[model samples]
Target: MSDLAYSIVTRDLSLWYGEFQALRSVSFKARNGLITALIGPSGCGKTTLLRCFNRVNERYGNVTTTGEIRLLGKNIYDEDVSLIELRKSVGMVFQRPNPLPLTVYENIVFGLHIHSPARLNASALDEAVEQALTDVGLWMDLKDKQKSKATSLSLDQQQKLCIARLLPLKPEIILMDEPCSALDVEATRQVEELMLELAGRYTIIIVTHNMAQAKRVSHECAFMLMGELIEHSRTEDLFIRPLDKRTAEYIEGRFG
Candidate 1:
């Protein structure tokens, strides 16, 4: 496939935190407009690798990284690359819902206010709020509640609102770190459905501990162990016929 078909690519990418190596020469390509799930046991570097894409892991002190990471074929570590623009292009959803303690409409347009080069007028802001909420299947429910505090919403709605907030920035990729970890089964299902609906429009890379969720929502799955990428393939193939013995063992209820 063409390089343009991949939204993110890592070549011999590795990361270290002080004396601890978190990722070990990991390399993979996540195709555009598809859901790619990173799965593994706890402390397996799944979240570390996901955070590396946006360079957010650098927030922690004593972090060191080597090798290349490319987004749309451009080396992200290039000195000329702007972190603000990189973050705008790559939105992330955390394990728990963390909406800004602002009104619903404000949350939706927050990204635009911060990232948009030109000041957006009231009408443009209004349109952005509507479109963003609509994109996340929340317009009908939250239209009349624009002024309502985002923190007042239920957990599921708050999570969806957090996702909606990223829309105005027009991100090319969405990184979700155990996005549904705090949700109930029904809410998890709804979020998964939303992910599927949004799949063809954005390249989504999710770090999920739930094996079933990996099978259900992702097109491709990558398994990691001790900071190493053990296997990556179609979700069906990864679950049913993993190429690596470790992957098969992990999926078959053996040691993590």
Candidate 2:
């Protein structure tokens, strides 16, 4: 419905887990190469909407969806779409860093190993690792520690590695669900900086309850209430002058 070109577009999309509906006719757009933050109280379906972009919710079982979710204008539910490819194109970063037990180098190239049409040579894999880490501003910090286990890294490093891992697959969109929630203030600031740096190259849709974070990191913000989208606007507008009373109330801390 937005006039802007969107990397993700949900058209009257709805979802349910058995009898409990989680999303109700939610329609929105996330513009290409921009950061869009989804903000809402707990159970308001922000995470659900983020997962819908990559169709990850179906893995939970007993879930059903209606309406359309288009990635770059192609309906994701189309019969021709490959789930593996879809996932590769739309990567995710969770609330807490959950790096694989493998070495840092291996973790960064894990997706490449899985998605490459042909097995990449050691040099190619190494290059991929370096580039991915460099993209995330981790090359200098982790280059010497590539042999170390990824889990052994600090929380911020692990989270950055999780994001780096997706790079080898060349994802067009990155879905981050509270990616900084587990880190301290300093680490949160660093990750926020990384998100800003990565925005022009990747469309980012982040779900966060931290209002300040949403304002600081996102170009656009969407507010949700009880699974319904209440307002969506530029970050400055939404914060300075919310169009919806509900949005104003939430932003003003009247109630979540």
lDDT of 1 by residue, 82-104 (tens): 99999999999999999999999
- Model 1 regions more than 4 Å off: 1-3
lDDT of 2 by residue, 110-201 (tens): 89888777878999889989999999999999989999999999999999999999999888999999999999999999999999999988
Local distance difference test values of all predictions, in order: 0.93, 0.93
In Å, residue 108's CA in model 2 sits off its true spot by 0.9
Clashes of 2: 0
Score candidate 2 by TM-score against the native.
Answer: 0.97
Tell me the TM-score of each prediction against the true structure: 0.97, 0.97
Question: Considering only N, C-alpha and C atoms within 3 Å, which residue pairs clash in candidate 1?
Answer: none
